[model samples]
Target: MLNIPLMSNNISEEDKEVLADFIRTSDRFTNGPKVREFEEAWSQWLGVKHSLFVNSGASANYMTMAVLRELYGPGEVIVPPIAWSSDISSVFAAGFTPVFVDVDMSTLAMNEDEILSHITDRTRAVLLTHVLGLNGLSQRLLDELDRRGIPLIEDVCESHGTTMNGKKCGTFGLASNFSFYYAHHMSTIEGGVICTNNDRVYQMCRMFRSHGMVRELTDEDMKREYAEKYPDLRPEFLFAVPGYNMRGTELNAVLGLNQLKRLDGNNARRVENFKLYVKNLDPEKYFTDFRMDGQVNYAFIVLLRQASREKFERLTELLRSENVEFRRGTAGGGNLARQPFVRKRLPDFDPSTLKNTDFIHFYGLYTGNYPSLEKEKILELCKLLNRV
Candidate 1:
């Protein structure tokens, strides 16, 4: 019964009406022209050459890892200790070892210094997750990756409009993933997309998304080559690689097309709300100087200036009394290295290796910051938070 919930659906009644109309009129409801149309629109928006819409953000991550595994066989992928389960799980699923790294407390993202130190000869790529819409990558990090010839994969599932150096976050990486879940900056109810400038990666994503069907390949010559290689099988049924059916539906695309129109404006409002939150929050009690230069604030991440178990307990109690909903530890289920799923694999794992991550795990929190959040409510929430 929280008055302020951690997330609110962005889809409006007008959006639902559009979806209803499409359902009633469209010739097909499965993956069809609408999906392709949405993909093109997203690519145009992200300034990427191609985009492939999929079932969920997790699927997008898995597909990207799958492509990388094909290009470079099993190796280590640098990942943040504080990220979504899928970010690490996808790496494992693709036969790559996940090398967990500490995060910078200010940005709640992988620490650039730690990432560089962890890069070994076995390092295949760096999987950077833009946690809670924060633009975590820096030019220095990108430069280092470029110098080392290591690919950068961006997981921008929580960051739809986040930018860095006048360019959008998804555009900087070799491949980028975005989520259009009901509660993200935009919504397709449940959809995800993978964008890339690399033609090979783009075609591989398409082939993997639809049961590895050669017909999904845009290159007619490649399709014909596959057909010739497998003359015993039906041309349309040719499976190139081991793939999964992670295709998104036309209904999801119908919603995405409309959502994209309002994404930037909504992100702007969230930024304004974050400014107000930072202005009103008591700096003595919380860490408000979060890195905001190229960040598109997703949730109001409240990191306590000092780690005190008692103060955290008091804050949570006050938040409950005021009915302010929040998620502890920000994003990804917090401290992936500490999670039982990861622990089972690396039984000797030491959580202390991620110093800043351990601090956030014990002290950080985040509440909802949607477009509809008002300055007055933000002020009120800050007052409640400070009272703790």
Candidate 2:
């Protein structure tokens, strides 16, 4: 562990071999066997009925929304402001309007109470995120949603190996999403998977993942004149709804499966590092661990007691000089929303829409955590941060 940087480079020889093996075989990029293998592994691991692979976490988000629009169109969905930029846009892309809500300060997840206040006759679902693996809000929010009979789609992208009260994190909601991004707990190089217990969602999502094509045709359609002419066509791949070309490649899935096999062990190591940070660092006056339920610690973070731009930059510079790399913990409204394109598209959008997210935008700072981070590196990070 050289002075801990944002994240250690994490592709191993084994992962490389897996990727190479997959590509050397099918290499067709689309409808490849490795994608199914990866999706199936995720489906079994998450205890969900179905899973679909996509190019990226953002692609998964947009696909989820696109599918949702087909079933439940033009409805209001509740989302926390403290989320990835793409998470917010998927709402608009799917023809639904996002009703941003404040988040609980501790969990940084959707504030159920605030959600209740925002819900109207138009409310259809809650796109909930288990922010930074803090899951205390999940059960309460789920209970509220149930009481109101509203549906929920979980964003478990940040909390893949996390759990609450012995139950897995992604299993609580109807449809849950996970990402195997380069910087995430697992590395697929670049890929995402959506999980669901519902048959309808599973059915719809398959078409959504593949450019809205009807992929699995029924016997009636296959027997018709269309079936005899096109042997290469799949009935299921047909477009049922307006969807994106969000299919995953075999290479990515092969890499992901290999990485997925080690997900638990990696999470455990990060937790060990998390405890080291807690035991060695002063918690009462400096930073708090956010008291998470089962954090994977993808990005070990803390909220500072004070917020000063100058101090923030100074600390960043100090860490940089020490050869430590870090990043401001992502706030809900990503740089995407603040970008010129989003601003113009949402010109009349109300500034009052996102409030709880503003706090995290400035106060949160995260040290990188990846499978490559060694014990020595974490210790070095602790020593450097404490020196300040």
Candidate 3:
């Protein structure tokens, strides 16, 4: 039996050679060809003015929130509870409180009503995650945010190629973060990118991602330094805003650049795989596909029928016996919001405020998407999972 896990890194040999060359050189500084090339490629792909590479998606999210706080500090970030644990922690790490909102189970994005209920004068940003590659959002929400003058920071970690009303998910917000973890829509081993059109955000994020070092200066900063010196601008590797070491390696950047080249094809494969799963699986046996139209699904995800803990174990054991892999669900349970650490840190916001989180823990699991598994393998896996 073939051992098909949740994900497989499909790194081409052609890409590996590119990474090997950058690794032998061993210089992450200077904003080299690979770095800029990656940024340029992603920027063009997402149709944004700037894309800043970072070590991980969590770092990208943290840096983005830090940049926001620098521009307008000590604010609140609204996020959905029924989602990845990273989305919540990153918000708190940014020195902003995370206001938990419920999810419309069908969409798995933020619940519009719950979002509005949480917003206040302190609410400065809304972090929207295109959960599981399904983009279930309406333009009405964008309009509401625009009217309120609050910025939207899209957490496009799960959704790289998803669209809403013909515009890409990552480009809709003022700034966004993308993950390239092994199981994501795409992978660069372990790397992430932050995208934004605002020059200030881009420069600040670049500096923040690299411990406040600005190798690639925006025009405004160059002019400021030039005014201080005579012929050439003096070096100012000074700390502007306090930052972190979140820079991506040149080797990883090369990998990401290669992945970026085949993103459309890769996501297309995921979309087709999702259609197959939905078409083959019993609609009554499983809940509806937690997918929205136009989503380039990152995984063939679903919600299970609510069952007893013992039955759950039996179900998983049965699948494992069949050599079919399944995910451990996305939501953080037991130790997430209720644990001593989170309770100590976030005592003000009651953990019970996120009721939907518990539901997410039990029912959610994905047969994560990857390009390596052929269509036949996927069909077999789903056929076994959909058994009555």
Query: What's every prediction's RMSD, in angstroms?
Result: 1.3, 3.8, 3.3
Question: Of the candidates numbered 1 and 2, which has the greater lDDT value?
Answer: 1
Reference-based lDDT, each prediction:
0.90, 0.71, 0.75
**Candidate 1 lDDT by residue in tens digits, 290-321:** 88887888999988999899999999888888
Show pairs that collide, candidate 1.
Answer: 83-332, 84-332
Q: Which candidate is the best by lDDT?
A: 1
Candidate maximizing TM-score: 1
- Look at candidate 2 and tell me the lDDT of residue 176: 80
Write down the TM-score for model 2. Answer: 0.87
Q: Which stretches of candidate 1 lie over 4 Å from their true place?
A: none
Predicted candidate 3 versus true structure: per-residue lDDT over 57-143, tens digit per residue: 888888888899888889888877655667777777878887777777766777877887788999989988787778857788888
lDDT of 1 at 190: 94
Estimate TM-scores for all models. 0.97, 0.87, 0.89
Candidate 2's residue-wise lDDT over 1-388, tens digit each? 2466666666789888877776677638765677778778888887877888888888878878877777776888887667677787888888787777776666777677888888788997888887765663556767878888888888888787777776778787778888778877787778888888887787778767766666532235533434455557764444456767787776777788788888888888877777676566546434664655576666766555566677666666777787666667554433234545456666876544555455556656666766667777667676666655
